[model samples]
Target: MSELLSVQGLTVTPANNPGKKLVNNVSFTLQSGKTTCIVGESGSGKSLTALSVMGLLATSLNRTSGSIQFQGNEITHLSNDALSRIRGKQIGMIFQEPMTSLNPVLTVGFQIGESLTVHLGLKGDALKAKIAALLEQVGIPPERANAYPDELSGGQRQRVMIAMSIACEPKMLIADEPTTALDVTVQAQILALLDELKTRMNMGMLFITHDFGVVADIADDVLVMFRGEVVEAGSVDEVLFKPQHPYTKALLDCVPDAEGKKQLKPIDYSWLEAA
Candidate 1:
């Protein structure tokens, strides 16, 4: 019932071009045990928003304005050392691609144990048991913990990423298009796994995806973003079935119905501007 993360008037701009605002006054609140999905086209600043929340924005991008509060404390201005204390401990992040995010040389189990060692100071038998349990929790066999990232399939790699993210039992999880590279079936399975974990851990999940199908499957609350601005935010039913914003309606029109009865329509930018 309590808000775990609240972002207000958040704005991101490229360091070279101060006029270019990547994220424009974006704001939202994520409650514990709930999943909020940010949906939009590529370059819509959805990923930037997530990075900003974790204070993980790149050096080239500047968080010019806004406030980010996590667990009732303002973190937007926190020092790197302070944010580092919370990054993998209280807040976990699953990036878009597991291959790029994970280390190719290290075994999956070792990577999962890294967070525990750093954050919780687990070692020896205790660390081993925790890593094995995490592997099983993400549906990976405990034996596979010994496998390298390249040795596993795409889905397995992602599960490893999930295992790493939740290794510390973070209160909030930020997933940036985590299922984008997987097949439909794998995507569904990943979504189910994430949803189950969220419920079991009572974590506030900020899931970013461009796919409406994923949104329909896992989101409790939906935030529609266009050009860095949230045009609509509401319960899944309200925004998906009875969308009020023109952008929301246009986005809905683009998704084919379950039965394929409704025709899929691409967004008409001119119409969005007009509306």
Candidate 2:
């Protein structure tokens, strides 16, 4: 099957210096219904790469050179209006912080249904039914639909964000640390929910985070980014277990334990015996 999203020769620069780059020659393909993780420590520009695909870069920065093709259409030069149309309908996003992403003044239902209104032009009973169904799909009760963000727990708020992201059933979803602020169990649940949604919707996923544990639990493929470049990338096993990059090894060394232990043993080095 053809790639659902393809990024080529992607390079991004800070607005302050149009010539100086932050994301250099970054590129990857997202296949339908599979999870691709962008893993790296801080300053790796993983999040920025995802933003470039969504055309959600900061107003100041520019795509110096490269093409972002969504289902064969080059989106690099797409207008703001065109990008807006493609955003919620063709590409959905779940930010790291749900509280900040969602409107404090709006009811959860309103925020969840806003995409339906914008992307599907849904209203009245159709919108109502859709919103209710979306809440349920994301594992939230219909009663809580009318509740404000302040009234919900951190996990529940994240659910609302997921509901909003999957509202239009976009072909591709970008989850930027969807489990950042939640408890361990809640984080597991959210990852499971995203996993289920991806399978059910047949959606491609670009999951960005610094957490290797989360990536291990959910990623099909891993792209290890370092200093704005993809140092290593392949199947999860290749990148996680049999990694060839020193930066990748350094990252895996830092996946901490609940007891606040010194470091974690390498997954392959500890998990299995050599064949």
Candidate 3:
């Protein structure tokens, strides 16, 4: 598989405290038709890493170093306009919270069609057909396009978000804890749907999450983050079943087995720091 996205020596720092690096020397590559998951507890810089890749970081945060290459193009220093041209069209993003990411005033279809209109120049019957197909693809009824974001259930709203992200047939997708707010069944459905779509489209997927179970289900490659650094990285089976880092082992121990047979153990940060 070809490399779809690559990041090298990526570093993010708080503007107020230039000395404090929030994301330190991160590096990874995502291949076409593959899902690379970045997993860690909250405050481990997972979301910040994703934002830096998308060029969506807050003004208060800055990428002080590193290069981001996408589809054979360098994106680390592209102008905002250049980035915008590629953002939704070639690189789609599914934010953590669908309710907050979506517009409350517009109908679901309109929001989904927005990018199609902007990127593909579709209109009239063509745009409508595309929107309907996207909604259907995500398992939402085409009729629900007329409904507001608040009217839909959490799972449905997320499905709509998925529809919006894939509207342009992007080459890569960035998903930031996309299933964090859903129930177990819905989470499973969403993960399965994403995996299926990724395979069908041959799109590279960068998924951020704290759940090891989700990683086991969807990831082709796994990168474990701890305190702004990549503590461990390997194939899903290798990292999940035979972690090298103590932090990785501690994290694996925290995940409960399906039969509830494995005892859940909290990470010992004090010992982690000592090591």
Candidate 4:
């Protein structure tokens, strides 16, 4: 697979507090048809890192330093207009909460068609046809396109979000805890759908999650972050089975075994103070 995205020396911090880093010198590469999972607890800079790549960092925060290259082109400093052109067309992002991310006032069909209309200039019958196809693609019935965000179940709302993200057939997809709100069965279904879509579209996926279960289910490569830094990075097997960083091992120990045989351990950060 070809390289789809390359992030080097990426850093983020509050605009007023440049000395304090929220994300420090983090780097990784994503290849087409592959999923790279960034696993960490809250405030570990996982979401901030993804937001920086999409040029969606909060106004109060600054990228500080980084180079984000997509399709061999630098995008870290692209203007708003330039980024807008690529945002929904070449790169799609599914935010953490579908209810918050999606506009409640609009119909789901309209929401899904927005990108098709703007980025692809699709309209009229062609637009309607495409929206229905996308809905079906994500396992939602085409008829449900008329439903509002609140009208759908948690899983359905997420499926709608997935449909919107893939509507324009972007080369890269960023999903930030897409399945966190769903039940176990639904979560598994969403994971499978995302994997299938990635393979079918040959799109590179950057999945952010705190769940080690999720990392095991979908990641081809893994990056373990703690306190805003990548403490370890490698293939899923290498990082999960042969962790070299203290933080990585601690995080893994917290995951309970399927048979309820292994004891769950709280994360130990004593090594941080020593380092």
- lDDT of prediction 2: 0.90
Model 1 lDDT tens row, 148-207: 999999999999999999999999999999999999899899999999999999999999
lDDT by residue (tens digit), candidate 3, 1-275? 66899999999999999889899999999999999999999999999999998899999999999999998788988999999989899999998899999999999999999999998999999999999999999999899989999999999999999999999999999999999999989999999999999999999999999999999999999999988999899999999988998888888888877785656676867766586
Q: For each candidate, how many residue pairs have backbone atoms clashing (under 3 Å)?
A: 0, 0, 0, 0
lDDT of 2 by residue, 50-154 (tens): 989988999888889988899988988889899999998989999999989989999999998888998899999999999999999989998898999999999
List lDDT for all candidates, in order: 0.93, 0.90, 0.93, 0.93
Count: clashes, candidate 2: 0
Write down the RMSD of candidate 1 (Cα, Å): 1.4
Task: Identify the superior model by lDDT, candidate 1 or candidate 2.
Answer: 1
Per-residue error for 28 in candidate 1, Å, reads 0.5
Question: In lDDT terms, how accurate is model 4?
Answer: 0.93
TM-score of each: 0.97, 0.93, 0.97, 0.97
Worst 10 residues of 2 by lDDT: 266-275
lDDT of 4 at 47: 95
* For model 1, the run of ten residues with the poorest summed lDDT: 260-269
